[model samples]
Structures are given as C-alpha cells and as structure tokens.
Target: MDQLHHQSERYGTDYSLAICDVDNFKKYNDIYGHPAGDSALQAVADSLASHGRESDGIYRFGGEEFIFLLPGQTPSGAETRLVRALEAVRNLGIAHSGNPSGTLTLSAGLSAYLPGHRVSSERLLKEADMALYSAKAAGRNRLEVAPEVRHIVRS
Candidate 1:
C-alpha cells in the first residue's frame, strides 16, 4: 500500500483500495467445518481475482478478508468493477445458510488516493475500513465509498 501511495504521489495517478469481507463467515465456519470454510475462501479469492484487471492487486488481508488495489482508477470506476466482483462472488453459488442471501456474499469498503490530496496510506486504509464497516452495517453484500479525503482535509 505504501508503494502504491508513493507511485500515485510521484506519477500523479489515481488509485482506489477496497477492503472486502465475507458476510456471515464465522457462522459459515461454525456450520461447515474449517476445511469447507477454507475452500469457500479460496473460491471467493479466485472469483475476485478473475474479475480484476491484470494491473490490479488482489491479496488476502486475513481470514475471510481480501483487499484489492485498482491503480489508475477513480473511486467511481473502482466501484463499478467492485460491484461486478461482488455480484460474481455471490453468483459463485457457494451455499451459506448463515447468510441472509442463502449463499456466500462479500461486503466491500472503498477509498481512493488522488494526487495532491496528500493523504497518508494509513489514513486511506482507515477510510476504507470505515466504509467496509458501513457496508456490513447497512446489510452486507454491498460496496460503500468513503467520503473524499480531499474534502475532509485541506491539503
């Protein structure tokens, strides 16, 4: 993330980061064994990876959580791609009776770094994390974007 921030700062490029978490994952693990949970996570990972562009960065943030870095993308553009990725994960048809959707789903929170915003990587991550929390709060399986940092902070 720091490297991406540096690149964006140096090249005056835009980049968005998303923090995605599997909804009802703990319940799924309790219902299905850990092995099944692992498989489900793998499936979700694969689906996310497949939906992203080659230049995008996909990584497992931790158990049941993944992060995506979309370089050269604005918040809205990243949202478009993430919305598709969210649907694709749901369409994977991985059963998760724990989830209200009756299948596995992802909730994502997105934040973007624009040149001249002078935002720190940590702040960007915090913004994304907050958005992710909002997504989960507003019913999972959705994407929420953090308010633009530029508006929140004056250079």
Candidate 2:
C-alpha cells in the first residue's frame, strides 16, 4: 500500500496493488503433505515471477499468500498480468496423490489507487480484503476488484 502511495504521490498517477491467496491450500497440503505444500508455493511463486516484468515486485507473504506490487501500472494492466499468472499456475499440473487429480488454484484481490487519490493503510487493506472476499465468494479460482475505493488514514 505504501508503495502505491509513493508512486501515486511521485508520478501523480495510480498504480496496482494485489494480494493473491492460494485456494484450499490447507486442505491441499494436508492431503499431499508439507512437501507438497512447498511445491505448490514454489509453483505459484514461479508463475508470478514469470508473469511479472522487471518493474513488478512479488513477495511471499508467509504461507499461501503473495503480495504483488506493480509500479505505474493501471488496474486493468494488473488484472491482465494476474490472469496470465493464474492460468500458468492452473496449467502447471502439479503432481500429487493427495486430492482429486492433485491440482490447485488461486484467488486474488486487486485494487487501484487512481490518480489524485490518497488512502490509509487500514482502508487499503480493508478494500483489498473486500476484493478477496468477493473472489472467494465468486469461486475458488477467480479475481475480484474492490467494490469501492476511498481515501482514509488508519487511526
């Protein structure tokens, strides 16, 4: 969120911020085991790495989640990249005897800090969370945009 704020303040334009979470990761891991979980994580990471350009920054936010930073990128652009990443992960076809076909999926929440806008971290995270909720509600493998965007600082 800070990164988005920085770029917005510096360039006076909005950028993209997304938080991706692996769907049913815990159950998938339990079926395959910890090693399988690690493999899944690596696969997701690789997908993100391949989809992102040099300007994009990807970070593993602990387990089953990733934080993506796209500097100077619009919301639509970020969505495009995420779509490719999601597909790449799906096509990976990871081998596991745990679940049905041993496959996995991901969900993402995306938000844009449009030009001439300011936001607080709390509000930013909340919007992202709302987006994520929508994604999960829609389906296991999908992305959702925040219902609304607003500016406010965390108290």
Candidate 3:
C-alpha cells in the first residue's frame, strides 16, 4: 500500500488493484479434499504469476483470494491484462467439476487510481473488493471493474 502511495506521488503513474478469488473453492475443497485444494490453489497461483507482467505485484491476500497491483497502467490496460491472465488459467485445463465450467476459474475485481481524485489505497481496494463481490454474485469466471471509479479515468 505504501508503495502504491509513493509511486503515485513520485511518478504520477496510475495504479490498478485487482482482487481475485478462486471460484467455488470451498466446494472444490469439500469434494476434492484439502490436499487437492492446496494443489489447485498452487496451480492457480503459478499460472497467474506466469501470466502477469514483471511490473505487476502478485500477493496471496488470504485463503483462496489473491490480490495484484498494476503500476503505471490505465484502466483499459489493466482490464486487458486481466482478461489475458484469466484466459491463460483456462488454458491450463485444471479440472473443476464442481464449477459450471468444469474447469478451475477465477473471478476478479479491478480498480484504477485516478490521477486527480486523491483516492487512498484502502478506498481503492474497497472499490475493487465491491466489484469482486459483484462479479461473484453475477456469476463467477469473470472480471468486473469498479463502477464507482469508472468516471475517474479521462479519455
């Protein structure tokens, strides 16, 4: 978080936060057992790390949840990167019979720092988190950008 603040102030570079959750992870665990679940999580983490850019920061937020920070990126750029990352995971072909897709999937929420908005890192994460919940509620295996922060970006 402090890195986010420092980077923004020092470089005036836009940053985007992505909150990701393993879809139907609990069901996967219940059916596949904890060891299998751990393997699945590790696979997903590895896939994400491989797909992410060198400039991006990946973190295990907790449990099946992961967070990433995209520095010096615009909203559209962050969205594009995430879309590709999701596809990369899908291509891994990890079986998840518990999910509708029958393959392991991820749902993510993204929020970009607005240059003039003075949004705090905590608030940025909250917005991303809300968007994440919206994605899960809407249905997993997708990504959502925080609606509240949509207008913060200028064309």
Candidate 4:
C-alpha cells in the first residue's frame, strides 16, 4: 500500500489490486479432509503464481483468500490477467464435488488506484472486498471490478 501510494504520488502511475477467494473452500476441507484442502490451496496458489507477472505481488490473505497487486497496470489489463488466472485454476482439474462446476474455482474483486486521487489503501481494499462480495453474490468463478472506488479524494 505504501508502495502503491508512492507510485501514484511520485510516478503518477496507476495500478490495480485484486482480492481472490477460492470457491467452496470450506466444503473442500469438510469433504476431503484438511490435508487434501491444504494441497488444493497450494495448487491454487501455484496457479495464481504462474499466471501473474514478476511485477505482480501475490499474497495469501488467510484461509482461502488472496491479494494480488498489479503494478502499473490498468483495470482492463488487470481484468485480463485475472480472467486468465481464473481459467488456469479451472484447468488444473482439481475436483470439488461441492461446487456446481465439479471442479475448483475462484472469484475475484479488483480495484484500481488511479493517479491524481487521494485514495487510501484501506478504501482500496474495502472496494475490492465489496466487488468480491458482488462476484460471490452473482455466482462464483468470475471477476468483478469496483468502478466507484477509483479516483476519489479522501474525505
């Protein structure tokens, strides 16, 4: 967040941050046991790591949630990368009978930090979280971006 703020203030660069959660992760733990659930998480993390660029930062936000920072990327670029990441996880062929897809899946929420705004890291995270909730509400295995969260001055 400090880096993102510095990049925005000093370099006038815009970037996107995304929050991703594995769908039906609790079910995986319940049905397959904790060890299998751990393996599944590792696989998902690998998928996310493989799909992201070296410039991107991937973080585990506890449990089945993750945070991704895409430096100097626009919303569209971030969305594209997320889409690929989602598909890569799906293609991993990890079984999840608890889900409708019958395979592992992820849902993400993305929020962009535009230059010349007074946005805070907390607000950005909240926006992405809200978008994530929307994605879950709409059904998992998709990405959603919070438009209103971008380019707003801090109050």
The lDDT leader among the candidates is 1
lDDT of 4: 0.88
TM-score for each candidate, following the candidate numbering: 0.93, 0.85, 0.94, 0.92
Off by over 4 Å in 3: none
lDDT of 4 by residue, 1-155 (tens): 67776767677788888999999999989999999999999999998999888989999999999999998888778989999999999999999999989999999999888754347778889999999999999999999888664334221
What is candidate 3's lDDT per residue for 1-155, written digit by digit as tens? 67776779677777888999999999999889999999988988999999888989989999999998988878889999998888888888888889999999999999988666557888888999999999999988999999866766643
Global lDDT of each model?
A: 0.89, 0.75, 0.87, 0.88
How well is each residue in 1-155 modelled by candidate 1, as lDDT tens digits?
88998998888888989899999999999999899999999999999999989999999999899999999987778989999999999899999999999999999998888754558888888999999999999999999888674353333
lDDT agreement of model 2 with the native:
0.75
lDDT of model 2 at residue 45?
95
**How would you encode candidate 2's per-residue C-alpha lDDT over 20-132 as one tens digit per residue?**
88888878777878987897798789888987899888989778888787878777788899888878887888754543435677788877676433565456566776798
Consecutive 10-residue window with the lowest summed lDDT within model 2: 146-155
Query: How far in Å is the alpha carbon of 24 misplaced in model 3?
Result: 0.3
Best-to-worst TM-score order: 3, 1, 4, 2
Q: List CA RMSD, all candidates.
A: 2.5, 4.5, 1.4, 3.2
Model 1 regions more than 4 Å off: 149-155
Candidate ranking (lDDT, best to worst): 1, 4, 3, 2
